[model samples]
Every structure is written in C-alpha cells, then in structure tokens.
Target chain A: MKTVKNESSKGSPRPAHVLQKSRLWLMYPPRLITTPVVWQLGQKHKVITNVRQASVTDEIGIVCLELEGRRADIKAAIRWMTNLGISVEPVEINIIES
Target chain B: MDKNTGFMKALKCRECGREYPLEATHVCEFDFGPLEVVYDYDRIKHSLTRAVIKSRPQSMWRYRELLPVAGEPTVGCQVGYTPLVKADRLAKRLGIRELWVKNDTVNYPTLSFKDRVVSVALSRARELGFSTVACASTGNLANSVAANAAAAGLKAYVFIPSDLEQGKVVNSLVYGAHVIGIRGHYDEVNRLCAEIAGKYGWAFVNVNMRPYYAEGSKSMGFEILEQLGWTVPQHTVVCMASGSLLTKIHKSYQEFMKLGIVAESRYKVHGAQATGCSPISTAQKAGLDFFKPVKPNTIAKSLAIGTPADGFYALKVMKETGGAAEDVTDDEVREGIKLLAETEGIFAETAGGVTVGVAKKLIASGHIPQDASAVLCITGNGLKTLDAIAGHVGQTREIKPSLREFEALLDKENKLINA
Candidate 1:
C-alpha cells in the first residue's frame, strides 16, 4: 500500500502516523532518583521525553514529564517504567481536589 | 447572561494564569494545571460585607457572592452554619490555652463537610443545565452528593471503593443514588470518574466541576472567622484527604483579609493525616516541595487519598504560613476520638480523630504554641464510620432491668473506679 502523507487541509506536511502527546507525573522512589531513567527511556523507546518540572531530594524524586510519540510506543514506555517500580500517573488526575 | 454570576470572574489556571469561561472544564489544556475559580474581589468587597452576611439566613449560601454560582443556590440550601463550639475541655486535655471545634459533623442534610461542596457544585450544575450529577468519593462525598442530588430532584451516581463501611454505603444507597462500588481504591474510582465525566458529560462534582466545588470549603473558614468575632485564629488544624479543604480554608482567610472583612493577622493552618496515608504531612515534615504517592492503609478511609491532588499546593500553603503537619497512628486516632467524645460530646470520624490527635501533638511539640488559640475542623460524624471504632470503644455490660442487678452493677463499678 502506498503511504499517504498526513497533512492538514492547508497541505502542510506531517508525520505519516498521527503523533499523540501525553503529560504525566513520574514519581521515583528514593533508590531510583539517580538512575537516569529518562535518558534510558529516550534511548530505548521510540517516544520523545521532555521534563517539564522536577524536584529531587534524598527521600524521593518527582518529575513532570511530557511524552510525545505513537500511542503504542508511549504505552510500552509507561509499562516499562512501571515494571521498574516507577509510579506513572496522568497529570490530569491531579485536577481533582476532593 | 440572563442570570447573575454572583461575583465570579472566570476559571483561571493556577499555574499558567490562563483564563477559561466558567464552565465544567477544570484543567488548563496547555499545561494540565488545575483551574481555580477567580472572583472579582472589588465587586465582592462592596456586596458581601459583614452586614449583608448578617442579614442573610445562616447557611453556606450566606457568602454567595464569593461562591462560584451563577445565581441563588438551589440545592442543599440549608447546609453550613454548623456550630463552632468552644472546646474548653478539649483544650485543657490537649494542653492548649484555647481551642474551638468547627463542628461540621452536623452540617445540614449530610453529616459531613462534603455537604458544603456538594451544595455549591449542584447549584452550579443546575445553572449549567446539567440534569445528572455524579462524583467519585471515598464515603462522605458520596453521601453528600447522593443526599443533595436526591433533594434537588436530579439524577445522581456515586462511585466509591467497594470496601467502604456498610454505614456509609447504606447512607448513599438510601438516597436512591446509583452507588457503584469500584474494586480498587478511591484514586482508581476517581480515575474512572474522570473518564466518565468526559464521555458522559455528567457533572462530576470533584472532577470537571471542581473549581466551583472546592470553593464551598471556604464557608467553613469564613464561619470560623465570624464565629471567633471576626478574628483569624492563631492556629487551625485541618485533616487532609486531597488536602483541598486545608488550602481552601487558607484561601478563605486570605479572602476575608483582602476584603477587609477581617483585619490582617498572621495565622498558621496546620494539616493532619493518618500515618498509613500521609503524603502531604510527610512532605511537609520533610521540608519538601512535593510528595510521593503511597498506597493507603488506614482506618481514616475518608482521608486515605494516597495521591492527593492538592498535596503540592497544600504544602505550599502550610510552608508559607509557617504551619506544621503531623500524622497519627490508628491507635492514637481511636484515642483522639475517645478524647473528643468524652470531653466535648462530639463523635467525629477518623478524619476528625486525625485532627484532634495531631493538634495534641502539635501543641505538645510547640508547633502550635501552648498558649495560642486554635481551631480543630471536624469534618464528619463518627456514625458514618462506625466500623473504625465499633469494637475499640468500651463495651456495654448486659444487665437485667431489676433494682437488685442495678445495685450490684453500681457497687462493682464504684469498686473498680475506686481501685
């Protein structure tokens, strides 16, 4: 099958497959604070990782991370992190105040 | 607009400062920051004076101008104005010079402070033309939303953890609300509701409608200030679930001071939590700017939010005001409940136990100075969480209703007491 370029009505070029962006909060346990997990994630996964905010202490590390890539790759990346004992939650979940 | 919007201006992102229309949406699209209801304080300053509030009926709606509703409240109108009792006996026991109990355990309709938030959310939901309202609650919020929605004649659905106490489950079910029991914890229930809120377009009080819903807690603080003769207490101890109430109470004090309704005064707003689920308190105690979520395992189910949404902001408020945070064990929680009940005749839930227990520790540790005045916010009644204290409270002795038996029991009790 011939791949058609994904484009808007204005005909600007885009990725062949739609890219999805997700914002997440990644919580690292005290032992995982210095693991360079984000670097490893970018090297291993097809997704791009951006750190929006981070607070590191001896006790714990919390990072506001934004991920952009194919949906499946993002899911796999999150699953990998979870397997490593990292807590991954959507940023939207933080909107609830009750 | 055909109806007045009270004094609310718009929903503004707490992080990015972006403004959105006062709608059901609760997060900023660009940054995922929580949106909060912003008010036109200049207008509220003129309209919501002490005289205007005094002339109104005693309810949370008495502060309508500051609440984020489009018009007069139509649901749970009788909520709030719960007594702020002088807790002299409790103060003496806790080693504090003065203390008050904001007794929200008897808040109208529902027996918890959730009634205040539900009233505001439902009122705003009606204005937004929603016919069905729902929420993801631990227990108290479910009870409040169920009861209030029934009285408002709106369809209601409340999702809660399947492991909630039977008393709370019955309270919600008795109101005819569709009470769903999720297999996981409250955070999971809340996650599912966030999706449902988007897909079904129902007014999820703590999800999409949170900005307005959270403003309801300010009433508790406003009442505290007014009941204290319009003066901010030197210290306030509030229990945290998502830590929303603590932050809102701080906001309430700030709003009153900004409006000149109360004189500017330095006050500390301490936070309390169960040790089994104390993300906010742990972070505050560690002097950290953020908190790591933990799986909750505590008798204080109402305050068992492992991943508190407002944990960061709550920490900021506590640190900014020079406040302290503390957590109590399950044993200490029971002791706190017994202390409050034996001293002040107030039967509070585990959350209240956490507050009372923490207040004692804070007072003892000098975080709350021994001589300073304080207020403890009791957010719920113990009846809803009887399971936590069922076997822990002293048992009743079975006695025959005969004079001989009564005399024998009195003699035995007197001997034991004397011993």
Candidate 2:
C-alpha cells in the first residue's frame, strides 16, 4: 500500500542523512480528521507508530504523525492530505533519547 | 544531594534501549518507538524502604527513590497519598473476593489524576528551558495542564472541544490559563496542537514531553502496591481514555517485580472504556491487531479520547498479560459513580463509574475470578463532571421551622416506618 512514512511514526526514518538523526515529527492543530490529512504523502508508506494528536481544537484542527513506509507513498500522502483540509508540513520533534 | 542511583538514571527508549541525557523528549529517532524514563532499580532497592518512605512525608514524592527526577522535586509536591480505601462493600456488591479503590478523587490542586501528570510536565518544561507549555485535552487534562502551568510560572495554552462540560472549562479558566474552545471533537483539537508544537517551541506536555509525563502515572500503580503491603494484585481493572495510565500501571508492576520490591506473578490487566468511545475494547473483542479510532460521544468526557496514543500498546499488554477490555454504557457509568459513592463513600467521576460498571460486567461474565484480588483505579473526582449526574443525586426537602411542620413530617415518617 502507498503510504507516508513519518520520520517519527508515519514513514521510514529519513535515510540516515549527514545529520544521522533518529526522529522527526509532523505536527498540526487539534482536529477531527487525521491520517487522511497526510494521506497522499504516506500512500505507499505505513506508519510504524503514530503520535496522532498533540491537542484537540475545533472545526479546523491539526494533527501530528510519525509513520513509516515506502518513500513514494510518504510523498503522495502529504500531497493528497493538503487537499483534504490538512496543512501538510514537516516537523522536527524529539520524542525520546536512549 | 540527589541520590546517585539507578532510580534517577538517564531516560531510555522502550522499543530500543537508546539512552539520552534526561531531557523532556518522548519519541525515539531510530524506529520512532516511544521513549520512557528508565530507572536504576538497584539504588531504589537499597534506598527506598517502607518505613523510610512512610516517615518522609504524606505525598507521592515519598517514593522519590523509585521516581525519575534529579535534585529536588519542583512539582506535584502536594499530590499523592490519596485514599487507599478497602472497597469491602463494592466487593460484596460485585461478588468479588477482594477489590481495592485507588481513590485519587481527592488529588490536590484538582481532583483528578491529571494533576499528577501535569505537575511533572510543567516542571520538566521549566527544566527544559521552555517559557510556555500547552496541551489538547478532553476535559480533565485541560484543567490540570492549565493549573500546573500557571503554578509553575509558565504561560499555558489549552485547547478543548467547544461542547466540553462547563465545570471543566471554568476550572481551566479559573486557573488563568489561555483556554480556547474548539467547535469539534477532541481528536481534531489534538491534531491542531501537534501542528502548533512543531512551529512553536512551547512544550506540548503529552506530545514532546510525553515520556516523562506518562511516568507520573506509574505512581498510581506504585501507590496501589505500596498500599497493598508491597504486593501486586492478581488482577487490576483500570479506566482507559488514552490508555497511557493502564499501560504505565502495568509497567510499574513489572518494574517493582524486577527490583524485587514485589514477587513476580502473572497479573491480569482489565481495561474499561465508555461505550460511546470503546475503540480499544472493541478492537480487543474483535481480535484486531490495530485499533480503529472512533468519534467519542459519552458523558464520561475524561475517558473520551477517540484515538488514543497508547491504545495499541494497551491492547498488546492486555493480551500479553491474559487480560481483557470492556465498555460500559452512559447509564451504567452514572450508576457506577452512584454505586461507589453510595456504597463506599468514594465520589468518583464518570471514568470511575465506567470502570466500576465494566468491572462488574467482567465479573458477571466470569472473566475475572470471584475470589481474585483486584483493583478498580478511580482516576478522577466526580465534582469535575457534576453535569453527568444533574438532578439524580438528591432533592432539597423544604420545610418551615414550625412545630406543626415537624409534627406532620414526624407523623409521615412514623406511618411509613410502621407500614
């Protein structure tokens, strides 16, 4: 399945870049709909796990996700989500350090 | 001096044992598995003793040797030490062998378990050099995040559904938090917070600081075992919203057993969810590996998170421990609350009612043994959700202070008594 792998839980960890980073987060405002908002970016990718929502707001809300999957789906999911009222954006979040 | 032992060791990832300098972070970078604060149990084993903790203070911090903070504690100093009331009557009513109520209803600052977590989140936010902290909450969490942030001298931004209980909204505002009501469900609101946290540096307690904040819930399990003479119960029935508390309590049990604080045993962990929002329980029943998030519609607003962060993990633990999950109706939730209050004098919020109602269901269905030792985790106070039981609690009996009035009332009482 096409998906958007969030560096955090949505998609595959960014191919160990020059920075050799471990985690990244995609954040949004509290909202009802999620995953779909970033559906295109993660179409082929699968979210290994997700942080889902940071807080809940109303009407037009936001959601943050950490996913994993193929690179193609991850890109498409983000593109598709923007059409669904989600302001698709990348986030640099650190959940833990071990 | 901060005791130099494993108790205050650096944080570690649960999915991967990557250790980081103690910072307020939650997710790991490698596989993105959630991180948790791991302790040095050896030091805790040697330092913390029943007698020593009992003599230190009547607070949650008394178990400092087992907690994961360095130096002096800066938050939740007045929390914990809640009632560990033996629920004999509740047991009798449910026909269970043993049931204990971890009555956090009287938790200080606010009467919910959120106080315990928010206290840690705000303090750790300050430690991480953040000037503001925020959260997207169902109701009780909003009340707590606002109050603790205010107390810790940090600007608090809280988001909640517009239709949240008035009591919860007022509670957040009264604490001087920047409370915003969204005109949608909690899941949507939470999505917004995640976005803002990325753009802004303000610490989102449950988002970035979730690892430590969640650790605060372990105190619930620790308190229960400590109150039970340092032994883990065979079965524990806990209320679920985000499923963090349930998973953490189980973590607490394993931690205690590993440290030789308690003997190892196969402890069953039962989860309770509101029928309006029972994704985890429903998934468990359907034997689905993943939880399908739902739009929550329940009077128990505290336990109303449609998409729980730890819902999957909660199911994993329940299955691994040979436990089960159940959901109760709104009517049963109220009855559960009233049943506990009337029978045990413990006024719990709607979540507690859900737990009591479900625990009874579990027993009736022969899921839990009739004579098993169990715990019903009452995570919040009922006063916060008074709207759920409006007009059902009691009615005022008006009477004039006259001898005739008294004589008539007395005659009615006597007649009823005789009849």
> All models, DockQ values?
0.17, 0.08
Q: Which stretches of candidate 2 lie over 4 Å from their true place?
A: A1-98, B1-8, B16-19, B183-187, B400-419
Candidate 1 residues lying further than 4 Å off, grouped into runs, are A1-23, A34-59, A65-77, A92-98, B1-4, B184-190
Q: What is the lDDT of residue B350 in candidate 1?
A: 90
Residue B112 lDDT, candidate 1, scale 0-100:
91
Specify the highest-lDDT model's number.
1
- Using DockQ, give the best candidate's number: 1
Classified by CAPRI criteria, candidate 1 counts as incorrect
Positional deviation of residue A87's Cα in model 2 after best superposition, in angstroms: 15
lDDT of 1 at B243: 88
Candidate 1 shows a clash count of 0
Query: Scoring model 1 with DockQ, what do you get?
Result: 0.17
In model 1, which residue pairs have backbone atoms overlapping below 3 Å?
none
